[model samples]
Target: MWSSKYSEDIKEKVLEMYLHGEANVEKISKRYGIPASTIKNWISLYWEEEQARAERSKAASRRKRRFVNGKELRVVRPTSGSAYIDWRRK
Candidate 1:
């Protein structure tokens, strides 16, 4: 698909204007010379991206960071009451 020459800042500003009810698609279309359909597309795309980002953050927050199935390190005491370092995995 061919991309527009308009910068992201301009697109974002247009989207904000439309989303905030400051202007309608047709009004913005006239002011910025962008098609109404293109503005609508940007709005939908932005919404989808925001939803995906929210879901990703929620998933990340739901995960655990604790050790899972890893070997533990500790000191061992024998019958002779001598403490020795145990570096073997059990």
Candidate 2:
């Protein structure tokens, strides 16, 4: 199947405009000459990407160890157990 390709910059701008309340989907579509459905898809895609990025950052922070009393401590979850353990305690 043939598909249309749009530049990343245009996608970002369209999403930014919508998210920032600068314009609604219909207005943006008219201004950009893109279909309303296409604009909605871009908005949804941008929102999902933002959510995934947030989740990744949270997971990364959870994985990082903290320094306390000159010792690095990490919170670890066992694969076979539901309990959480502090690495410094064991």
Candidate 3:
């Protein structure tokens, strides 16, 4: 099977064009010389990532709102090298 490698920048631009109502999948496929199915796959992947990011932000915000001694405490998560945390506020 032959595969074509498209850079992230090109994928993002094509998805943006489709999302902004500037063109349909068929037209975009023709213009960019990409298959309609490939374009659709890119759009689907973009939406999945976006939904995951939204969910992560929501969970982080929920974790941030904690009460201790009638005072709100902010929870901070380390951004690197650690996946486990005891989020209980002391």
Candidate 4:
């Protein structure tokens, strides 16, 4: 059975190998005995297509509505882990 947890270093190494064209996920999975699905997940998480990357950048500046303390507020939360709420925006 494969270990349930793998270190970040190991993941980085695998990602690098894949990105560098050393091998595709199936080959890497077989070589390292890891599941191909797991490697694919890492690729999706780490590698964004250009359109997706741009969309993500746009979303960072977008404001979404949320209810906080019985008030509908527009919250602009960037990917930077900070949030600001505009109560008057609604």
Best by lDDT: 1
Deviation (Å) of 22 in candidate 1:
1.0
- What's each prediction's TM-score? 0.65, 0.64, 0.69, 0.50
Off by more than 4 A, model 2: 1-4, 64-90
Clashes of 3: 0
Tens digit of per-residue lDDT, candidate 3, span 1-90:
113598777787798899999999999999989889999988888789889999999997776466777665653457765554344545
Q: Candidate 3 — which pairs collide?
A: none
Best by TM-score: 3
| Cα displacement (Å) at residue 54, model 1 | 0.7
Task: For candidate 2, list the clashing residue pairs, or say none.
Answer: none
Model 3 scores a TM of: 0.69
How many backbone clashes are present in model 4?
A: 0
lDDT of 4: 0.79
Worst 10 residues of 2 by lDDT: 81-90
Give lDDT tens digits, candidate 2, residues 8-28.
778878888999999999999
Give the Å error, residue 18, model 3: 0.5
> Where does candidate 1 stray beyond 4 Å?
1-3, 67-90
Scored by CA lDDT, what does every candidate get?
Answer: 0.81, 0.79, 0.78, 0.79
True-vs-predicted CA distance for residue 66, candidate 1, Å: 2.0
Q: Rank by lDDT, highest first.
A: 1, 2, 4, 3
What does candidate 1's lDDT look like per residue over 1-90, in tens digits?
A: 225887888998998998899999999999998888988898888899889999999997886544325754555677676887655444
